[model samples]
Target: MGRGRQKAKATKQARDIKYYSPNTDYSALQRELKGPEGRATSHFANDPVEPDYSAYVDKYADDLQEDDGEVDTRRIG
Candidate 1:
């Protein structure tokens, strides 16, 4: 057998790319209701709680509100 340059075989070609329409309806989602100062007032206004950090917040209120002024501080530890 003699060594020869093998021609590359052409594979299946892909058709036109399909794309989804951009989400333009911002009001479609249940947005967070803002208070008079434009801040979230209700607890449910924020993202849904998975493990529920409220209990942890209550458990460590003293540590959480330790002059830092930040509401969420469970990650400090």
Candidate 2:
């Protein structure tokens, strides 16, 4: 088909889909929304526990403090 005909066909299909509303099955929707049975709600239920990094942060707190609060960005090779 020509470009104009193809574009017209696409526009008609888009309009039809935009105004179309099929019959909804509420029970099926509810079941689908509620998700599968006997499954844990948390997806991260099997994730490994993370170790606390507060100790490292506390150790480097004084070393990380700025003296003049200004960054020197001049290139140093």
Candidate 3:
């Protein structure tokens, strides 16, 4: 190959790429859920068909309790 073409082939072979998994913190989510602005944000973020948990107490009464604020790792992938 010519000089310019040879360099292009060598550069392509020398290149390396790697991908990493993203890290997500669930604790921050709990803080957001308890925060004032979070309540309003949650309302706008949720589906209209779904009941709002922040305003309605009985909506998620079966799924949550006052003392049950712990994160469930079992549900995570």
Clashes (N, CA, C under 3 Å) per candidate: 0, 0, 0
The Cα error of candidate 2 at residue 7, in Å, is 12
Instruction: State candidate 3's TM-score.
Output: 0.20
Cα deviation in Å at residue 39, candidate 2? 2.4
Q: What is the TM-score of each candidate against the true structure?
A: 0.25, 0.39, 0.20
| Deviation of model 1 at 17, angstroms | 23
lDDT by residue for model 2 (1-77), tens: 46999899999999999999999999999999888999867677578989998889988888778556777789999
Evaluate residue 14 in candidate 2 and report its C-alpha lDDT on the 0 to 100 scale.
100
The candidate maximizing lDDT is: 2
Candidate 3 lDDT, 1-77, residue by residue in tens: 47998888777766632344457788998877578652444446454586556866778687666557776569655
Which stretch of 10 consecutive residues in model 1 shows the poorest summed lDDT?
7-16
lDDT of 3: 0.66
Error of 1 at 52 (Å): 1.0
